[model samples]
Target: MTNDIIPVILWCVPRSVSTATERAFMGKEGCRCWHEPLGDPFYFSSKRQSLRYSEEECKASGNWDKDIVDVMQTLLDPEANNVGTDKKGPVKYVFVKDMAQYIIPRQTLEKIHKGQGSQCYRTDGETCGTSRCTGVDSEGEIIENPTVIPTALMRRFKHTFLVRTPTKAVPSYYKCCQDKMAGFEFFDGAEAGFEELRILYKWISNPRSTFNTDKEDGPGAVSFPGKAQKQPLPPPLIDASVLLANPASTIKHICDQTGIPFDPAMLSWDAKPQAEFAKWGAYHQGAENSTGFKCEDDGAAKTNGEEAKIAKLPQEVRNTIERNMEPYEWLVKRQTTFA
Candidate 1:
């Protein structure tokens, strides 16, 4: 509404509360949800022309090219895709949210601010657009719709990036594969650096995801919040053992980073519905099995309290999340308050 043209780009790893975030915005009136630019019911549709995509496509689009974002947006343009153009609801905001962007590269993202023409296209093969590109599966069989034109579709609207915890990220990515939504070979031959992802995840969820946008650590690299803070490197960012050893300090640390006001929502006694397209299905029971915030001041390795059920996940889960959330860390921190 501010004429500022804030093309909000909502970003998240699969099953990382993306839909929940989208729903929250939708509820605010002025927003229209676009599901994941590439997810569900339609991506796997047996029909050739359902005009749908799943997060998996975005994941496998080769490199996490910044142009991929622009191209994807271009493909979603109502002028190109013909569906999103006439959309209307309480919110006129355009959400270019999808879990797949996490697997892409920094240069590709840097290109996002530049505009189209930077995108790499399917030059030799038939492209996906305007009755031109061929709509084929990985094996080359034509599907119902034509090729998916990332460049042509997404160029029509504004963009933003929403991000979250890395611990939740890998779990969700794995779950997407388990549910037949994606493939185990998705990351095959790709630049999947787990240690790097762990750092990126924590950084992005700090509400400053974009502060260091268009930047990357060369190698053997680590980024701390400030120049003065000095702590030896280890499993946990700020001396995990030391911080975890003190719960109160841990909570304060979390507060310092995320800027998300601690809330009673973390201590809810209500049951939570099964997460849609969630990788943490093992933790799911049903909507009736809702749980509430159980934040406590217990002295433990996870310094954060009961409100940190999410902030303080098991180490193994946290490790998995760090490994997978290499991409899109900026958005992760930018919207740290939603949960």
Candidate 2:
């Protein structure tokens, strides 16, 4: 919220090279990026008792409702040193990379069931005036709504959705599951990343967004949370293929779309993970192994891009790929293309 620092949120699905994107932002001088601030909370609030991570590990991750609230507050804290400078002076943005799935609608239901009520849905005074999290879906259907995260909180930042073809991202995500010792049975074909991305995009597109205001609770009052009153432009959509195809152009394009100055440093970074990411590096090895985007190849080395290899994949995995394609294509078509 500072005059000098713009808060940016990069929301992507698992194995989208999102960590590398975060590293790109981290490369910018004076910019500090968080790996996944909402991860622990999301894990703690999850109802999946038979998860791969131990219950103790999940508990150790922390409570979702409390953690998200804390992060929202911190990101908006005026006194914090969220702004840093390069040769151009003050830093223009603070980036946070998070998986779209980290925020859960099911967790909201779990909270309500526990009598925690809707307090978990509140954001800063400017972004959220009410506790109700209702919105119209892409289909124009209106119904009772429980946000995956507070809508008010989401409106506070410049958001970008990083997407990859499911034929690639799904199998890679499965590999991560295996690496973590989570059995293959955990993979769900129905939990496509685009489904949640669309939900977030639609909510963000709505003009009736809650935001900070002087009146905490009043019958009727106008509030301002973001840059202006009208619905802001749709968040920037960057395809992973586009990013890898030409990292410099893609990163600059993203900076332009988000209103932040492009920093050449964003094109590359040290291969090592940041100290804050030490606890989560095991899951981020792809990013850790890469110093920058791969241009010599199509960025498919990690992914089995061959038709033969894809055909050899388990039938269930192929089914998941088939199911995810519709949404993935829906998003990819909207992405900003570089030449």
Candidate 3:
């Protein structure tokens, strides 16, 4: 049952054009698209209460855990849904674009896959007699993975990750929450102030990370002093800003690590339809009346004298974006070095 499912893992910070990028891949040839919104895609909604199987369903017959295992198998393989969606070409590659939230904390995910994938993490209160959450122990205090779905079953799936810039991500996120590009109420008070949001910007901009690990995000993120720590904090998941800033260098970075050819189209939507502008309305509620970066769509427009607002941001946050971007600036300067 192993189909052509190519797990196109979208490792991205929120507001990093993930939805747009996914739309591009789905529009490609022979790729099946499934949205792991929050986590579960296809059947279960987020309001999903939990395991609803009776004792017989759990033990004697096909158990909840076993059932999920089968479903994961189907998802990893090819599906009719992915075939010929692209009128321009024949379908062969099946793409599954989702966030790394599926594998929060990393170690837990690795443990699950160690054993055919466990359904313990996917338990609902009814089945496991507990809340619909998987407790994760990190830094000491235990917290729910927040986004852990049917993990044991889908643990082994692999996917490609897309990363982007932090500074741009901040404004974009603000726009989304305000409803310019497609945001949710959860974003309410998302950017109460520029300084506060700047710290958040650095958190999501870790570049090396892309999934929400039990709300494991959000701490006052100030810039690294560049003062090499006694041991240098582990680099972020993947320096997304690094990629967006230097396409040529990004090309080599991807090849050096994954051996995949860099398709220029990966950076920008080539077939972006004019009507797609309206699609923003579907995801964002407040976008109907925003100016430039305030809206989810067409945020590329520069603001009139927004520089006056820079000082409004906390010095720590302002410094993070600037200092972090310096490496990219350096790379651009050495253009002759990039492939």
- In terms of lDDT, the poorest run of 10 residues in model 2 is 115-124
- RMSD in Å for all candidates: 15.7, 7.7, 14.4
Q: Quick one: best TM-score, which candidate?
A: 2
Query: Candidate 1, residues 1-339: lDDT per residue as tens digits?
Result: 222222334434444433443433332333344545443322332221221234455345432233333444443343333243333532233444554323233232222212222122112333324321232345533232122322122222233333334444454444454454533323211122232233333333222232222133223222211111111111122221222234344433332332223332322334444333253243233212534212323456554542365445445444455544544343333332211
Off by over 4 Å in 2: 1-4, 45-54, 62-65, 78-92, 107-134, 137-146, 181-192, 206-232, 296-305
Please give the range of 10 consecutive residues that has the lowest summed lDDT in model 1. 226-235
Each candidate structure's TM-score, on Cα atoms with residue i matched to residue i, is: 0.35, 0.73, 0.44
Worst ten in a row by lDDT for model 3 = 224-233
Each model's total of backbone clashes: 71, 8, 22
Candidate 1 error regions (>4 Å): 1-6, 38-91, 100-159, 179-339
Compared with the true structure, model 2 gives a TM-score of 0.73
Candidate 1 residue 339 Cα shift, in angstroms, is: 14
lDDT of 1 at 76: 32
Clashes, model 2: 8
